[model samples]
Target chain A: MRNSSLIPFRSGGGILMALIVAAMAFLACFALAGALGASKLAGAWTDGLSGAATVRIGAEEGAPEQQLDIVLDILKSTEGVIDAVPLTEDEVAALLEPWFGAAPELSDLPAPAIVAVTIDSANEPDTSIVQARLDGAATGAVYDDHGEWRGRAASAAHAVRSVALGALIVCALAIAAVVILSVRSGLSAQSANIATLRLAGAEDRYVAGLYQTRYFWLGLIGGIVGCILALGAMVSFDALSTVSRALPSLDLSGYWWFLLLGVVVFAVLVCVLAARITVLGTLRRGA
Target chain B: MILFENVGFRYGRGPDVLQGLSFDVPDGAFTFITGASGAGKSSLLRLLYLDDLPSAGKISLFGRDISTLTRDEIAWFRRRIGVVFQDFRLLDHLTAAENVALPLRVAGAREVEYRDNVAEMLQWVGLGGQMHIRPPQLSGGEKQRVAIARAVVASPDIILADEPTGSVDPEMAERIMQLFMEMNRLGKTVVFATHDADLVKRSKKPTIDLKSGTSSGGVAA
Candidate 1:
């Protein structure tokens, strides 16, 4: 009924415990964000590349317009191919501007004409069938489905998500460890008070509840502090135009806040459970 | 009521502090445990309060063998007994009333329910005016009274005290002894342990002299 802690915890160890939990929660926030961001990025990259392809016609593949027309005809006739559109010479130069930086002599060099093709993801046209048909009409035309690049991007994103999740687990464990140590220290420091309470006929649950409640609140408060800090960092990242562009997929949706709340709840649970187990164990041994 | 049969106790792997002892304290009895500094007086009291199990032999409290009691059952049994520690073991940060209410609090009584009882208990101990004073600010005798108030506030069936009046003057000691006597009058068994021979002789109560390794006077009413 009395909510005050019998064990005095206003010591350096308690502060240190809070700080450690805060640090862990802070890192956990970033790790959770990274995992979520990687998942979203993977979906975007895979979807962007999966259902589309390109057709490249080299200069030696006869007149550019004639080769482009042939590739378009083949794609349009193929089942599962949504639409085929050719790129003009100026559009090709614009695509290459990042690499060539506006070279005036670009027209003197031999460049391939390109055609973009969209396909139904659920029923993609067979690349082999389309490539064979194009090769029969124009020998230098090459069909590209972008499947290889998509797979690599998805793999990279998957690796990032896995690492982030692993990091989150490590942070949770670290928080648990810190709480355990802090509770053990509190027990040792207040061993006399504990003995007094025991002699006063206090149940083990009552004694353990004191520490558990204190540490639970400590963890919850620390988690909120860390989350607030993480939110500030995220908001700042969003405000920075260059960084946001580099990490464009980090657009935190509503689910991001929900997941962060989950982290705080998990942190409090870890603290309460750790304190309860430690105190009970120590009391049992003393008894 | 408590019964001890051939109780032998040792601290950890050390030699026995008390050896081959037996005594029975009937309900509502007031018994004094007497000995020299090392005659196992405090050690024997620790046994009665269930702080430590006997290294050998058996102790039964309220007709239950302590050795067979589970941890929870032990706690439940302990709640029926109260202890006034030798050092007055009040928390330095807590006020006199808070210290006295510990037993009630441990029993899960709400403050609103036990608050008046705590104030009344402190008053009974002559510490009503010092209820809000912390242990550090209270005198030795005041702390002793606070301890006694704490011990009996929960209305336990037994009160075990170890040198409760050792830190106070003779006048305070007598007054403290009166508090225990009052508790006994209320049908609670009181076991007092001390090296104060004068106080024991003055009270003329039954005593178990550990130096003799047996009961001296028979159990008292």
Candidate 2:
């Protein structure tokens, strides 16, 4: 519990400081949640892309069924290949529906046969060796591990994560700035109380502790409010997304809640530290 | 013991408010610092409380030179000397008991350890029944008593009262002076600054006349 009577700051700027902390904490929560969400999204994309490969056999290359059979046999014989399955004509048409629409021409266009191959993540087949085997037998077969597109997707996901993390850091700095300003204003407003304390033989650190404790409580309360609001927002958005089927749900893992808790703790620690430093600096400078 | 030798002080870039003041306040003695307004009575008390260092010369409190004390040492040294400001300076938000407990609180004593002592001190100052009242609700004399109680609560070896009775009626001023006198009898040195000559003369204590920058009335010259 705080010894609030020692400083009498409750009447002056307490509410303003708490509200400011709440607003900054609110911003910080969003930044942290965005960063955590982006990190999970990046992991999902990387995993999905890394665990699969595709084998495309042209229709003009010998008998298309023979070409497909040769490619499937080579992939099945390959080490680290978990499963290989050929896509049906209808499945291929469905894959093309996004760009070509429901046109009958997509099926009549002599599309190449595609074999989906799953690989053991611990050990993937060498694409070079697979391509060589296909080139010798299935003439126009193309072995694509999707490494290029996967790299691009991974890079994009990483950039999003980085941007979110940058935003989180910026939010932290902004919160610290607000804390410093509030502490300064508090110091000014409570000058008489401070002078009385100092004259009463209160050490600088002891006086600073009063401010630190005040801000610590403010930070904790405000951070909790902001975090709850952010969590409610995330849950509501997730629920709305489920109903509308537009954006994906937040889908935060269990450990991500611990990360959110860490954000609250971080805000509190930042406020305590900012108040301590500000008070000590101002007291020393005035001294 | 408080000792001053050829001491001088001034605000930044301004003329000296006090100059060449030399006096010794014997331990356990009650000394009055009497002067007109701006004659440096409060300024001298400020110096004694380590609020401002003298612009020139030396002041030794309890045998340690004030100019040579480290910041930490100065703080620790200040714990031995209590100050009562003219305005009372009681935190208006705190009750009379809380205001009286300020010195002990600042000295790091927990409430459990000092609660009884605070109550007793308030009772000693004749505010036993009004302990729960805030300073704003208290009369001027009651507030001054609270301020006095706060000053002496930490058991400081010396009490420096700067016009502590300046805001009260004569009867209340005498009561305040009696409290200081009681403190002095208990072995705490008291240095009181006031412009009220009648009060000073009535007390008949040693006087440091700041107006003429001289020591008289049994204080060491």
Candidate 3:
């Protein structure tokens, strides 16, 4: 606290550094949000589809009604099948209502018969065996356990998360670089002051502490401002469009305090570390 | 308290500034190093302060060989020796009291413990009323007094001054020399480097005259 008077209370470069930290923190928060959102979406999709599958019966081979009955019977007898229900024609039409516009012409279309199958967690049935049995019992029958689509969704989410992580890393590096440059400039400006301190028998830590404490507070203030701004922007954007609504709701209200605390702590640490290294390096070289 | 054996020094790749310099100053002695400008008087004092190491000779202080001391140990040694520069070198932003309290602060002393001592030192040097003023607001003589107060406030064992009276008038110069003499009388070794032959002759203290780099003659009393 005594050395606080040795350094100027206000530096233009310090202000600039704080603003840069704020911007970086803002971008970092958004990147983290993107990563979290992607992870949540992937989890939701996996949870919705993990225990269910669908079967399609073609009308080209035998009578569609007969093929449906045969496929339903086979699914019911399977050990892992919890329930297998064949879809009525009216239900199939309702499923296609969104695309067909509820027109009477939808009834004339050669839509295949569909059966919904739920599997028990204790006994997972092999879909390949199920499809083979269906083919033998009723030609042109197909089984779909949704594995391919789930894998693709997982891979897409992973790629998005990776990009978000890459963005966060880039923001961190930029923040550190800004802090280093700011501290270096301040040191160069105060070289004479530093010499006076050194001649007074002050150690390297003493001099470096002056700058680190200043930058640490600046970083904390900037980080808080940035986090608030980012959250505000998210809320505004979510209100303006339906895209964010379609994704899983973040509900940051329950955990925002912790997130803000994390951002402030991280920012302060980066600033202090950058300033310490810069000051120590300069002093060592001068020595 | 100080010894040098055939000390030699030079800037990087430059010719020798001081060579084959050998001398010793007894404890509690008042010594003056007199020379023309650039005759290496400041450079010699710098060696004693460990600011610059001897290039080709050995130097010892307080009975410990300086060449063997680590950087931290050298800093500790420096804390015991006070240095006064010609430029005053007071931080322009700090008040006189703050400037005088710098050494104690650097040593990590609590402010409440040293506040009264700093104020008493300032008053002793005749700057009691100007303690709250910054360096830029003080006169040149007053600044020099503040610098002297700062140098001696920590009660360092040795005080090294480089041209302490170079910028002040004759009356003020004598007053400043009286301060250093008073400190010397109190058992602190004082080594002053100056080009003022008149002041040197008036004091009649032991003087080391340097002409090029080597000592001109043995210590002249």
Candidate 4:
């Protein structure tokens, strides 16, 4: 009745509890967004390798060096082959060292050239024709189209994305629950105030509106703060550059309105949840 | 006007505090309800203020059946009735002026519009110098006076007070009673529950007597 405090929005323990829920809602959303970013980063790797393919050719070393030259000639004359580069002996050795020990126990190691082929989409070659011509014993050339591997990798990435998105939804529901619980507790604490309000001719809506607006602002302020902290963390990690793996970057440049809308809607929803619980609980008190 | 017909209440497994009670408070009349401790006097006041619903029978406020009204509708009807509790129940965070203006504020009247009225009401309750003081800082009598100011500030259709003068001295009690009288004289129906027989005799209002959980006198008038 007589509040001397300037920031006079105290509704006892209830409002404080509501604020706590609001903060939790914001943090939950923050965690959800982080998971989303992580999943997106994982998915970006497939996009990076979209336009590349590798061909591995295995041949006997005892066979004359003429076979290697023949394969190279055919690759050059091929319509879809924009360029073909064969790996040197040392380059092949370096690539195999990670998989096997570098020293060879036996001599005459039959090492075949690995060719990277780039196709000109304007004159795409028929893979079947290329494979049929190059699969002979002299060449032993194998076209290892990366599309199937890329597809599997993309599927894994999408799986991660789905799991992360699901986690985000659970977090949002957790936030909603916290909002409801906090509001109910807050209403309980202010039972006297509510009774006073009711007797003073303030309807349920008026009482609920007070809590709704208060929690809405709380969620908005907390959500924006969480988003800013998330962005700062992103920039900080990128600055470190220790993880060259591209972390999922938020496309925030043109999406400010979306973020604003998210903050507003998030705040409103949390507030509405809190207000609904409080109003219903108070009304049930038989006041 | 307010009326209760065959009203009864039992707070879930507890014995009935009010039972088979019937009373009508006429429009714009000042009345006193007197009883001993736990005599259901406060319970009766609770019914009029819409704080407790009748467990049975009917309660009429402004000629509408309160028993059938929704909580929202009851709240709306209650806005026209002001209540002062024994505990004063002033929101501890609000200033005296704000507390007094609470009724007007709840009614959605602009502060600019209600400023003069609230100021006059505070002055009438003899709390002019303490408008800025919080409830906790005020003395018992001062708090009681502030509560009285809040009750009548909105010029409500009815004012229900439960032992409003219970904590004040005789002199202060008389002052608070006079304020209620003035409000009633100005056309607001007034019902005050009190143990202070002296205050009741001094005001000379028609009295409703309750004893041992039952009305000792005739139906409320």
DockQ for each numbered candidate:
0.45, 0.44, 0.48, 0.39
Best by DockQ: 3
Model 2 CA deviation exceeding 4 Å by range? A1-4, A10-13, A57-115, A125-141, A252-256, B68-72, B196-206, B214-221
Clash totals, every prediction: 0, 0, 0, 11
**Weakest ten-residue segment in model 4 chain A by summed lDDT:** A1-10
Count: clashes, candidate 2: 0
How many Å off is the CA of A6 in candidate 1?
A: 2.3
Which rank order by TM-score, best down to worst? 3, 2, 1, 4
Model 3 chain A scores worst on lDDT over the 10 consecutive residues at: A1-10
TM-score for each predicted model, relative to the true structure:
0.85, 0.85, 0.88, 0.73
- Could you give the DockQ of candidate 3? 0.48
Compose the digit string of candidate 3's lDDT tens values, residues B8-98.
9999889999988888888899999988999998899888878778899898899998889765677778789988888889999899999
TM-score of 1: 0.85
Model 3 RMSD in angstroms: 3.3
Residue-by-residue lDDT tens digits, candidate 1, B15-134: 878877878888888999998888888888888777789998899888988888877777778789888888889988778888898888888888998999999998898888988888
Q: Judged by lDDT against the true structure, how good is candidate 2? A: 0.84
lDDT of 2 at A139: 89
Model 1 chain B, TM?
0.95
lDDT of 3 by residue, A111-185 (tens): 889998998856779978988888888889899989898898899899999999899789888888988888787
* Top-lDDT candidate index: 3
Candidate 4 local lDDT, A1-287, one digit each (tens): 33232223555644454455455545554555555555566567656654455667665544535666767777788777888877777887788778666867412576666887777655667777777777664456677656677678767767766776676566566666666766666667677877777777787777777777766666665556655555565456556554554554454444544644564476557657756676667666654
Residue pairs with backbone overlap in model 3: none
- lDDT for B96 (candidate 1): 85
